[model samples]
Target: MHIGKPHEATTRICQASAETVEVRGRDLCRDLMGRLSFTEYFCLLLTGREPTDNQRCFLDLLLIAIAEHGMMPTVQAARMTLAADPDSLQGALAAGLLGCGPVLVGTSERCGKLLVEAQSRLAAGDDAKVVALQMLQDIRKTGGKLPGFGHPVHRPTDPRAERILELADARGVSGPHIAMARNFRAAAAEVWGKPLVMNVSMPIAAVLLDLDFPVATIKAVPLLARTGGLLAHLAEEQQNPIGFTMAAHAEAAVTYKNTDEGGG
Candidate 1:
């Protein structure tokens, strides 16, 4: 018995024939090989269209901004995975990418969706501050935390986030979405009675939204950037060998506790 649909199979992303390969109707070898930057090519591959100049520039900037954050959990996972296997590069990379979830590199997508929700409220004629506050209140009532509003290490603001917004302003790409993010920041401070740091995810979402990036693919930006970082870490892991040491450190860092034995 078939578990699901078994007869559906099609791909519009690429078509290859006996002598040539094509992506989005462009010849891979002759038309795109040296002409498109990797960022431009990534845009094409994902959206089936080339990005505008601003889109390309911001995309490249965001990628660079997120590519390396020294010794992040994903990097450590990749390093340890490489150290354990020492042969399976793909496995090591997969180990790292698997860790990109709501708490880590995946927050950009969630924040983008949140901003879009706020934009909808704005479109409905509510003031930006009201929308932000109501959204925060609603999230809090449900025991939910606001996405993209705080970082463990970066206080007040994330420099990468600030740079992205600054560049967006300079390039005239800061639009309603960015405005909504800033309004959310202000509203969060008022609601929480303290200044909460705005991390890179918010601006990553805001600027990408301003650039007309598809919300569905927002997470891909971080995933792709972190892949590069993971590769770098894996390479260094091969050279320096730390996976076993990290494992040993973890073993030493934890202790089992028994209530009866402790009381006795």
Candidate 2:
């Protein structure tokens, strides 16, 4: 049984032989291994082409920027999963990665799409500010949340986002996407009647788009980066387990009642 069309199937990503492996048209062991850093290798693998200096720099910078953030929910989930089953490290990591959604590592993908749509409207000759404001209005009309414009902890502006933008401008890579994100920041403040946090996800998407990264896999950035972070958390969990403690805290913080009576 097949779920989708199964026809002429092919893959240009990789192939292997008796003694050699090919990746993106390069010899894996010869041209790739030991020569390219993981960041460079990742870029090549993703785009099937070598990244320029700027692309490479930003990719590395972004990975470092988002790889770890204290004990985020994703980290907590992984740690908890590990505490429950100490032997299955992979399972614990999967538990964390599976939680990537609108509020987590997946936010960058939404932000990327948002920037791309704004760019499209700007391509139609509309003013950038007007395009941004109209898109903000549309999102508000649908009661949708803006993806990259707020954070629970990072107030006023996300330092990571600001750093990425500053680096993009210094490197001369801040293109229309970055501009659109900033425009949206301004429009959002006006539309929402107050300033909102311009979080890291906005600059992440903007820089990747400006660097011509693939839109469909923009989430891969955060997914891969957070995987590194989660692995670190899992390692620490083994030494000083706090997952169960976190679970206990969570249980104590919330009040529960039977649904037939009342719930909170």
Candidate 3:
């Protein structure tokens, strides 16, 4: 029968059989060469293909841009989950994703769409400045933060946006969309009397549009990249138990009421 033993890696089902198996030792560091940087590694894992150098750089910027933003909802969720009881990194991340539901950390795609719409308005014979200015005005009227314009944390210019724009310029990647983005930046400065340099989402949207990704997908890339940081934070929380406290922040905040309430 020649069935003395079976290899550890192989499994047998209720039968007397021996199987020969071959295994290769993995070199953690060696597997990283030419394997794309962390940014491209994300793409490879998600899209099942390696991104080109430009794509890699773009992906890297996107990942780093939103890697952490001072205990945002996603990070809070991850930490909170970890505090209950330490678990696998993936488990903690899952908790964070639960908190980042569509409304929380989902605006990149909308910003991308805004750029596409801005480009379309310009292409249809409208002045780029006019279109961008009108968009800014509309955002203000609606109490919506202009997605790719100014940043609350960064003044003068968002560092990530500046870097992406520099890379795009160095690569000689000028086009109508890029030109429109520049025009938009100029218009914002003219209206505000100060530079409202592009924010993180701006360059992200610009790069995706340049790469021909649908505007809607631009936001998705951030969500995807931010997961890496979310996972990292969750792992961190497991080591040091401090859950997210945003819910408490939300509950303890103040509220205001309209004074002209005679009609009511």
Candidate 4:
């Protein structure tokens, strides 16, 4: 059976032969191994091109910014999974990464989409502030959330978001996307009654887009960054053995309601 065009397996990322391995058209052993830092290597591997200095610097920055945040739910899930099955380290990592839904480390992707949409509208001569206000109103009208805003824990503002924007300006990389993000900040304060804390996700998305990183691959950065965090947290869980304690706390935090207990 055949459907549409015939499929062929291929990847531009890497190919290995008996003697040498190639990645993004560079020799892994000769060209990339000693010459590139891990962050630069990551950029090359991801985009198939070496990054500019600003790109490499901020790629490293964003990775550090999103890497660890106390015992976030993702880390807790990893720790708890490890506590339940001490031998399955891989499963624990998978469990943690699985928790990176849109509400978690995956939030930057939504923010990326938001920025892209706003940028397209801006390029079409729509005023960024007006677009932000209209979009905020539409989302509010539909009872939907605007991504890159709000946090369950961080208050007043997200300091990491501020720092990222500051660095972007310092590095001369802040562009229209960053401007639009700021416009959202102003529009949010006016439309939402109070200022929603613009979290780190927005800056990460804005800076990367401004630097010309592929819009589609914006999520990969956070996912990769959080994986490093998860590994460290999982190791800590192994040493301190708090996974079960966290589970116990979770159980104690909520009462078990049995509406049908002996009702039959």
lDDT of 2 by residue, 156-249 (tens): 7789999999999999999989989999999999999999999999899999999999788689899999999999999999999999999999
Q: Give, for candidate 3, the lowest lDDT window spanning 10 residues.
A: 20-29
In terms of TM-score, how similar is model 4 to the real structure?
0.95
lDDT of 1 by residue, 1-264 (tens): 888878978776899999999999899999999999999999999888899999999999999999899878787788788888889999999999999999998999999999999888888899888898899888877889889989999876799999998999999999999999998898888878899999999999999998888899899999999999888888888888888898788789999789888765
- lDDT of each residue in 1-264, candidate 4, tens digit only: 786888896899999999999999999999999999999999998899899999999999999999999899889999999999999999999999999989898889998999898877888998888999998898899999889999888898899999999999998999988999999999999999998899999999999999999888899999999999999998888899999999999999998768788545
Summing lDDT over every window of 10 consecutive residues in candidate 2, give the lowest-scoring window. Answer: 255-264
TM-score on alpha carbons, each prediction: 0.94, 0.96, 0.69, 0.95
**Candidate 1 Cα outliers beyond 4 Å, as residue runs:** 1-9, 259-264
Residue 117 alpha-carbon offset, candidate 3, angstroms:
0.6
Better of 1 and 4 by TM-score: 4
Q: lDDT of model 4 at residue 45?
A: 86
**Of candidates 4 and 3, the better by lDDT:** 4
lDDT of each: 0.90, 0.92, 0.68, 0.92
